[model samples]
Target chain A: MSLIESTATELLGQLQSGRTTAVEIAAACLKQIDRHDAKIKAFLRVDRDGALARAAEIDARRKAGKPVGRLGGLPVAVKDLLCTKGQRTTCGSRMLENFRPPYDATVIAKLRAADAVLIGRTNMDEFAMGGSNENSAFGLTHNPWDLTRIPGGSSGGAAASLAASMVPLSVGSDTGGSVRQPAGFCGVLGMKPTYGRVSRYGLVAFASSLDQIGPLGRSAEDIALLLEVIAGGDPLDSTSVDRPVPKYTESIARPLENLRIGLVREHFGEGLDAEVEAAVREATRVYQSLGATVSELSMPHGKYAVATYYIIAPCEASSNLARYDGAHYGHRTDEKAMAVELAAQRKALQQTGDSRKLEALDNPLIRMYRRTRAEGFGAEVKRRIMIGTYALSAGYYDAYYLKALKVRRLIRQDYDRAFEQVDLIAGPVAPTPAFEIGEKVDDPLAMYLLDLYTASANLAGIAGMSIPCGLSTGGLPIGLQLQAPPFEEERLLRAAHMFQQATDWHTRRPELS
Target chain B: MSISREEVEKVSLLGRLLLGPGELEKMTSQMGQILDYMHLLSEVDTENVEPMAHALDLTNVLRDDTPGVSLPRDEALAAAPHRDDECFLVPAVLGDP
Candidate 1:
């Protein structure tokens, strides 16, 4: 197999045995990206020169008998949302089109320290808002499995890159089901570690309370390896827990015995595609046959997760995004141009004899702010900001934002109750597999429903992962989701690894040109 | 739960965003539909449940009170669209402050 097709674990063994050099691996990945990324649109920017330079440095260090870091020479793609010093971190929005951070995000620093070569910045939903990558300002990322379909988003680019064999590993942030849903659609492994398990200091905030950075890779062990490097506490992010990082790679080989997996009844009811449900059920049967028990369970409040997330995520987003006001950083409106336009509008109103219209062009400062934001953000982003602003406004906060928070609590309570009976929850990652690229673009609510099965894990701040189960009749991949209580990522990875070992789903790759 | 053009305008103003004439109508209806869907949360009985601000029950995560290095001025100002030396430039805040 070519270097790009090998898993990170296999590449590591070859690197240690001196059978392959870091430069060769980097070149292979770069070659694949150069050859295929045009059609996949998986990356916003590819750092060819930087990646090659870093790989050569690692190769030289190895030759000089210097200790190499874990993940040495491996090419990793990063979601554009993460801040990388001196590199353009657009967050998939025009607001930060040319913006470059002066400091590295905690996770980026960790990856660099581990000797991983940063290959490129992947595309994402603008500011990580939309359920599909169609919201990206750059362009939508097409699924490598089928160019006509969308690789579920906002981490669609990361997952697509993995499916296309452009990179061995990638990092993405999950706000709702961004990482896992896309991973499922693209037929790979994606994990969202517990909220505080991974630092969020440099991840462009979408919904601060629900967002967590995680890894996407071809295999469960690959995901675990990336997670081990990125997970841990940092003084920069106070919300990051101070717990010791577990050896996720070591735990993946442990036997799966006497495991109690809960099959959520609500997830299976109406709206779930028949093929996806069948694949998930078959996965459960496989687990049962492997000396594990599967029981029917219910989280009654699971139905409200989408509603709660819509309210809370937007409310937080309105506040988090308020920082881009054309002053400090990001796109700024031209004051002279605005003045000219306002003067022209006032003159036109004067000619039309409309005093009210003339009087409305009063506050130039406010006009500048509004015009800048209007021109900077996209349609979905504006809708969200407006929704959040209205939800948090006076006389409406208690009715909307507060009510959503209360319902969020009830959702968590539902999970708390269910966890008392089961060790982990298993179900469909999304309602369906990959859909046509433009299928749900016009209907926002229809797109939101696609996240029905996955958003609850984010709302409850638990660990969750999506592993390939089977393919639909249309030849698209389906994913089986495994969710665990907060901070139990090791268990989540182990369960997924055990399932993967017994089945060949995770081993299958899409036939990409 | 039905949002009107006037309400959308008000909310957009609050969000510091200007909507085009056609966008106003679209946003009003879209926001209405989303709000109608979000109305499902009101159906759930959350009267006694406390509001959850965050998933993990964290409170006042404070760090040591010490001076630390901050981003250098040049690098910090590198991304600014409009900036003067040592400060970001903006439209006049007050007419004659």
Candidate 2:
């Protein structure tokens, strides 16, 4: 295999065997990003010189027989939202186009300490507010399978890069399927650990309660390898659990015998593409053939999972995103340009002789906050903020935000009930395969429905993953989702690994000419 | 359960964002549709259920109250759009004092 196409596990063997060097691996990844990224638009920025320098240091350390880190010489791509000191972390938004973080995110620091090469920042939706990369203030990323279709987002670029073999391993965050859905769309392995399984110290918060950083790679072993390095608690993120992270890499090889899998009845009916449902059901038959019991289970509350997520996610987002007001960091409204508009507004207000208008609209600082955000955020962001603000607003709070939270509890209860009967729950990751770009761009509700099967995992805070199961007749990829009880990623990975061992679906790569 | 245009304006104000002239109409309808879809929550009976704010049961994570090395001031202020030597700059908070 070409250097870029080698899995992280394979690359580690090659590095340990002294058959290849870190500089060569980093150069090969950089070359692919340079060669293919113009058409894919998967990366916002490429750190060519910095990555080579770091790779050289790793190669030198190995030559000197110094102790090398676990991920000693691998090249990994990071989603743009994670802060990397001195590197521009755009979050696929113009607001942070020039903004550089002063400190690295916990995950980035972990990657560096593990001796991995930081290839570059991948593109994502602005603040991760959209289901599609179309919401990116930067350009949208095309699916590597078909140039006309979306790769999926707000981690579109991250998944596309993996599918195209631009990078063997990449990291992304999921708040309602940002990672898993795109992984499914691009035919790679993507997983969202139970909430709090991974630290959120430098992940740009989308929905604090729902967001969790995850890994994307081409194989189960690669996923398990990357997960162990970035998983584990940190003092920096208080929400991160202080629990033991099992060596997922070692456990994935030992397949769980007699695993009980539940097929969510709601996921099989309505809106699920026939091809995807057939593929997922076929994956179930594979599990049955492997000495596992497959049974139909009903999650009555599952129908409302997407609605619950839309409310809770946006409400949390409205509160979390309040920091970007053009004050301390990020984009600020141009003072000189705003001065002209403020003068015109003041004149109009004075002419109106209205105290309410004067009191509410005349503040220069308030206008700056309003204009800065209006210009900085994209359409989906504005819509979510508007909905979130309205939901959390007075009198309506009980009707929207509070109600959604209560439904969220019921969704969790449903998962807990299912776990009593089964070790894992299996379903379709997304409703369908990657649709043509702009197909659902105009319909926000249509886009929200894309998370129908995936959002429940986030809402319930369970470990969930998407692994390639089959291919659509149209040549797109279909993903089978397997979710486990909270913090049960070991079980989740083992099940995915076992299924992958039986099917060649995970090996199918998109032809990215 | 459609939110009115006036309500969307009020909500936008609460979010500290100002929609441009044409944007208001488009967003109002878009938000209205989303709200309508979100109304599906009303179908479920959550009368006895408790609201789950977070998935995990976490208490306040307190640490020792001691001074620790912090990011250098210049580095902390490096990305600020408007800043002085010591503090970030913003428009006057009080109006026409």
Candidate 3:
């Protein structure tokens, strides 16, 4: 196999055995990115010089007989949301287009400690606000499978980079299906580790409670290998749970004996495409053939997932995004223009003898905040913020935000009850394979529906993953989603590993030009 | 089942997004439809259910009161849109300056 097409584990094995150098691997990945990244648009920034320099350092360490880290110079693409010290972390929004983070996110630090090279920053929806990467202020990421379709998002670029053979591994954040849906669309493996499994210390915040940095790669083992390095507690993120992260790669081959997998009845009913439904059902049979018990599990609150997520995610997003007011960092309005406009408003209000109105009009700071955000954020972002503000506002708070939280509890309870009967719940990752670009961009409701199957996991703060299961007739990839209860990543990865062992769907790569 | 333009205008003010006429017209209808769809949550009776603010039930993570390093001032101001060497620059908070 070409070096570019090799998974992270395979490349690591070769590197450890001295069969290939880290510079060769980094160069191969960079060459492929240069060849096809224009068409794929998977990356917003590709650090060719930086990646090679770091790889050379790793190679020198190996040559000198010094210890190498776990990743050992493997090139990994990072979603633009993760803060890399002295590097631009735009979060796919114009609001932070020129923002350079001064500190590495905890995961970046962890990856660096493990000797992994962060080769590039992948594209995402602005602040992870949309299901499709079309919300990205930069540009849409085209699927490697078919250039016309979207590679689902807000982790679209991360998944696409792997699918397009630009990198063997990538990392992204999942808040309401960002990681899993894109991995499904791009026909790879992605995991949203149990909420707080990974620290969110320097991850650009969207929905503070729901967001978790996830790993995406070509196989379950690759996801597991990366997940082990990035997962754990950090004092920096207070919300991160203090728990022991299992050595997932060490025990991934051990399949659950007499495993019980649940298929939600609602997932197969409506909206789910016939092809995706067939694929997941076939996967269920594969588990059954492997001597596992398969049963129909009813997560009764499944239907309410999208609604609950829409309310809760947007509310949290509005609160989290409020920090980008142009005061400290990020995009700010020109002060000269603001002064010009403020003087006019002040004079107009003074002529009307309205001191109270003049007090508001004369405040250039408030006007700057308004104009800065209005111009900085994109349409979908603004729409979400407006909706969130409306929901969290005085009279509607109880009706919208509060009601969503109660339903969120109900969703979690559904998972808690389902886990009582089964070890894992299986379903189709998305309603369908990737839709064509511009298909749902203008239709906000349709775009939100793309999160239908995936968002509930975020709401419940459980572990969820997507692995390639089948291919559509049109050559698109379909994904089977497996969800596990909180902090059960070991089981989740093992369960997904079993499917990988049984099938070759993940082995298939897209015909990238 | 409808969100009025006036209501959306109020929301824009609250969100700090100064929407123009065209965006306002479009957002009004879009927000209305989204809210209309969100009304689906009302069907499930939750009068007795408790609100879940976070997924994990972890409490506050506190450490010893020790002074440690924070982001250096120069590094903190490095990305600021408008800044002096020492502090970030902003428009006058109260009135013209």
Q: Considering just chain B, what TM-score does every model have?
A: 0.87, 0.88, 0.90
Candidate 2's displacement at residue A191, Å, is: 0.6
Q: Highest DockQ, which number?
A: 2
Candidate 2 lDDT, A333-385, residue by residue in tens: 88778889888877788898877876776378888898899888888888888
TM-score of 2: 0.98
lDDT of 1 by residue, A270-384 (tens): 8889999999999999999888988998899999999988999999999999999898788988889998987788779899999876766647778888999999999999989
- From the highest lDDT down, the ranking of the candidates is 3, 1, 2
Give the better candidate number (1 or 3) by TM-score. 1
Q: Per-residue alpha-carbon lDDT of model 3 for A337-447, expressed as tens digits?
A: 878877787778789899977655525777789999998999999988998999999999999999999999999999999999999999999999999999887899999
Supply DockQ values for each candidate.
Answer: 0.76, 0.84, 0.82
Model 1, residue pairs in steric clash: none
lDDT of 3: 0.91
Q: What is the RMSD, in Å, between candidate 2 and the native fold over all Cα?
A: 1.3
lDDT per residue as tens, model 3, B26-67? 999899999999999989999899999999887877899999
Decide which is better by DockQ, 1 or 2: 2
Order the numbered candidates by TM-score, best leading: 2, 1, 3
